[model samples]
Target: MAYVIDGDKCDAKITWLPVSGSLKTGELVELIQLVEEDDKLSREALALKDIFNDIIEEGLTYPQLGYHDESRFKSYYLSHAAFALRLANSGKVIGGFYIKPNFPGRCSHICNAGFIVDMAWRGKGAGRFMAEQYKLLAPELGYRASMFNLVFVSNQGSIHLWESLGFKKIGVVPQAGNLKGIGYQDALQFYFSFVKE
Candidate 1:
């Protein structure tokens, strides 16, 4: 059955709440490992020749936002600047998210985020849940806007959902994504504004 889940108790948009929690630091390592695994969710790693592969080899289509070198990705998480969230029910993590300040100085008010759900959990509203949480959480974390830098234009589900949540298409990079078999495709940029409440 369809249910309603709000960013907080205030904004009453209804969806579903399948999970909740701030991902632990230790769990960040676990997510990195999973992201690098040679599986469906690991598409970001498909271009990598090694765990420590060069970013250029992966092509621009790759969602490397989460797969940066050990020093970079970890520094963001360790510095308490980037945060990851996991969807959990009854003590198990089912899905996850990575979010952080988009810039260092004046642009700190803007944040960026990425999400992933267990393939087994896809089509179950987990993505929606996490997004709703972000709407609420971003402001709480001192962010004014949450930007999605490189959304695949073909990812209709996400495009539709983000629009429903009031995110706007701000720009597009022509032929910025390398689609396997299909060659390159445009990368759509999106912005979601989160105001103080």
Candidate 2:
């Protein structure tokens, strides 16, 4: 049930999965819309509030993302999508995730990733499956470790999922994220090492 994905630099040890009865699909069009909507909320609320709306409108694309021409949004998701996974069922996109080097130059050895699952498909072990894939894929892409920069304190499910996967708590930035109606909340950072030294 598991396969390894190897990249140019290392043996990923990742299990990149394909649609195989892991889930059932409803409407393909609706699924994409659901992913977009959830992405909009996360970008606007629990993420950087500066260009929240713009990022939502422009989306995580390359060259042109909303009104801005350049952003980590494009660089990570659009540029480094080679090390990624697209989860679907019945030709409908259930989830997608991407892993990128967390920084440039000296910090390029470390990586970061983001996963988004359609709202309707949540609570069905989709995220857990994707997270496991990313952890393995990251190492093969020449990364020694992986990091989740900002996890909203209110998102108990995600916090629990990452922690259960052996990712450690690096630090917390209090009242750093705005949850729309909920004002501001703490953002937690998590890290996982492929090779523990």
Cα shift from native, residue 98, model 1 (Å): 2.0
Q: Residues 1-197, candidate 1, lDDT per residue (tens digit)?
A: 12222112122222333333343222221222122322232332322222223332444334454445645543332223222233332333444455566655667677777565544455666667667777866676567898887877867887888899989999998977766556777888889777745
Per-candidate TM-score against the hidden true structure = 0.60, 0.64
Q: Pick the candidate with the highest TM-score.
A: 2
lDDT, candidate 2, 45-71, per-residue tens: 222223333334533211123443335
**Every candidate's lDDT:** 0.53, 0.55
lDDT of 2 at 140: 61
- Which of the numbered candidates is closest to the native, going by highest lDDT? 2
